[model samples]
Target: MASSAQPYHFGFKKSKNGELPSIAQEGFMNILQKNGSIFLGDAGQKELYLTFDNGYENGYTAKVLDVLKAKKVPAAFFVTGHFVRDQPELLRRMNDEGHIIGNHSWSHPDMTSLTPEQIRTELDKVREASARITGQQKMSFVRPPRGIFSSRVLETCKQLGYTNVFWSAAYRDWETDRQQGAGYAYQQVMSQLHPGAVILLHSVSKDNAEALSSIIDDARKQGYTFKSLDELKVKMYR
Candidate 1:
C-alpha cells in the first residue's frame, strides 16, 4: 500500500565527553516528544529508564530478568514476533514479573523503509500476539529495530496507539564474541550515565547481563533511580 508519510531517520549519536544529557540532545528529544515520540525522559530528573531490545533470545534474557527482579528494578523488554513465539515462557515471565513487554515490530524490519500499511502490519502482528500472551492489548511502547526510525514510522506507530521509545545510552554490547571485560562494560555504561537517560541493553550479551547488577548498584550509588519506560513522562503530542 502507498503511504503519504514523511521519513525522518533517527541517527544514533553518542557524546562521550563525560558531559552528557547534552542540551542539543535534549532539544532533539523535546522535538520528538512534542511531535509524539520520545528518545529521553524528562530532562529535569536524575532518572534512568532501563530498556532491552530483544530481537531474539540468546539464552541470557532469563539471567537478565533475574538481575532485574533481584534488584527490584523495572525494565522494558522490546521484543520481535520471533521472540514472543520462541520464548513464550520468558515473555510471560517478563510480564508476570512486572516488566513492560514492548513491541519491537513483528519481524524487526527497518521501519523507515516501510510504508504505513506495511509498518502497521509489522506492529499489529506483534501487538496481537503480545496481547495473547500478556493480556494487554495496548503495548504502550515501541523501539524501531536497529534504531531505524522516521517521523512517518513514529507517527504510524502513534496512530497505532504506541509511543516510540528510543535510547540515550547504549554501547557495542550486541556482539556476542567480541565481549568486553566487565570493567570495560561497567565504564561504557557508567561513563555515559546522565539525567533522564534511557539506557538500552541487548538481552543477548552475557557481559551486559553480568555487569547489569553492578551497573544498577553503581548507578544507584551515584544517586540515579531506575524506572520503567512507562513511568517516564512524554509530551505525546506537539
Candidate 2:
C-alpha cells in the first residue's frame, strides 16, 4: 500500500463531474497531424522530465522524496489503482509537494489488447478514484502499462481528456529481484538524457531508488533542470 502522503501510487479516483477538461478542437486537429503521442514539453531548452511507475509502500519512495525535496525538484508519478487503495496518504503527500499524479490505469492492463469500452472502464475507475482522493479533476495525463497503446486506446483517452505519455529513454529496471546496481543504472540513464527527454523509471526498483539522487546530480551538473509533466504544457496529438 502507498502511504497517505502519496496516493498517486494507486490509480486515479473519480472526479466530481466524471469528465476531463475540454481541448481546443483546432489544436487537437493540429496534434493529429503530427503523431499519436503528445509533445509534452518544449524541446528548446535542455529540460528533463522524470517519471516513475508502479510504486507501492516501499521505504524507497521516501528516500526518493527526500532527494527531490532536498533539490526542490518536482516529478510525476503514474500509479495503479491497487497502489491508491492501499496508500492514500502517499498520494496526498505527492499533491502537497507539488508533484503531478497521473493515471496508469486501474490494474495496469495492456490497453492495446482490450476493447474500447474495457479501456474506458479501466481508465475511468482510476480517474474517479483519483479525483475522490485529491479533490481535483485535472488529471490529464496517462502512460499506458508497458507503453502498449492502439488507435482505439488513443482515441478513447483523448475523448476522456487525457494525453498519453511515452518515454524517450528507459532501461531494464522493472525486475526487482535481479535489479541492476545504482552505478550501472546511473550510467544507463545519464548517457541517454537529452533535450526534451522523458525518462522512465520504476519506484519499486532498489537500483532506481539508489541511483535517483546521483542521476539528478549529474544531470544538473550538465545544466539540466527537471520538470514535472504538468509544467511541460504537453500538446496532445492523435
Candidate 3:
C-alpha cells in the first residue's frame, strides 16, 4: 500500500460534557485501529493508559518519574533518538522501575511523508539504541511524531513490527515557554477524564510534573485507574 498526498494527522478533539469522544472518527483513529494500532484501551473498564512523549529531556522527566514512583502508577515513555542517546540513565531507571519504554522514532519525522524504508529506519534506529539499555526488552509501541499518519504509514509500522499508539487526551503541554500553569494543566486533564482514555502527557513539562501526583490522586478518587500498555491484549498486524 502507498500513501496519498495528504497525511493522516491525529487531531485530539476533546468531547464536551466530559464524555469520551466517539471512536467513530474516520481517518485519525478509526483507520489506525482498523490497521491494528492502539489509541485507547479496555473499552469496558474505567482505565487510563498513561503515556509520555519524551523528544528531549527538559529537566522535568526525573521529577515526573519520581511522582509516578511515589504514586505507584506505571506509564509508557516514548523517546526519540536524541532522548535515547542523551538520557540513558533516565531510560534505564524507567525500565528498572517497570515502566514501558516505547519508540518515538529516531529523529521524530512525519511517517506519512516518508517511504516505508525511511519510516523503518527511523523506528529501527531508536529500537536498536533503546535495546542496549533495555536489554532484550520489547519496545512494541510507536507514537508517531506529531501524531500524524496515513493508512499506508500505519501499514508500514505494522510491517516493521510496531503497534502505532495514539492518544485520546492531550493538551499543548509540549510548548515549554507557554505552559498554561499548573492549575490549568490539572483542570485540562481532569475535565477530559474518560474511560479507556490514552492520556498523552509530555514528560518535559514542568506543569505536568507539578500536577501529576494530584492528577493520579484525584483520578483515583473519581474511580479511574491507570494501566500500562503491557496489560492490554492488542492485535498488531503485519
Which runs in model 2 stand beyond 4 Å of their true positions?
A: 1-36, 39-41, 233-238
Model 2 local distance difference test score:
0.71
Q: List the residue pairs that clash in candidate 3.
A: none
Cα lDDT tens digits for candidate 2, 13-117: 111221221223323333332334553345566788888886465657777777888888888889899888887877877778888888899988777677778
For all predicted structures, in order, the TM-scores are: 0.89, 0.80, 0.92
The per-model lDDT (C-alpha) reads: 0.80, 0.71, 0.82
Summarize candidate 3's per-residue lDDT along 1-238 as a digit string, tens digits.
Answer: 4344368667755744557665454444547666678876665678888999999999999999999999899999999999999999998999999998898999988777888888888888898898897784567888889877778788888877788888778888999988877898899889888778888999888899999999999999988888888786642211
lDDT at residue 231 of model 3 (Cα atoms) = 81
What CA RMSD would you report for each candidate?
3.4, 11.1, 2.8
Give the range where candidate 1 is weakest over 10 consecutive residues by summed lDDT: 22-31
Candidate 1 lDDT, tens digit per residue, 56-85?
899999999999999999999999999999
User: Would you give me the overall lDDT of model 1?
Assistant: 0.80
lDDT winner, 1 or 3: 3
Which segments of model 3 are wrong by more than 4 Å?
1-5, 23-30, 234-238
In order of lDDT, best first, we have 3, 1, 2
The candidate that wins on lDDT is 3
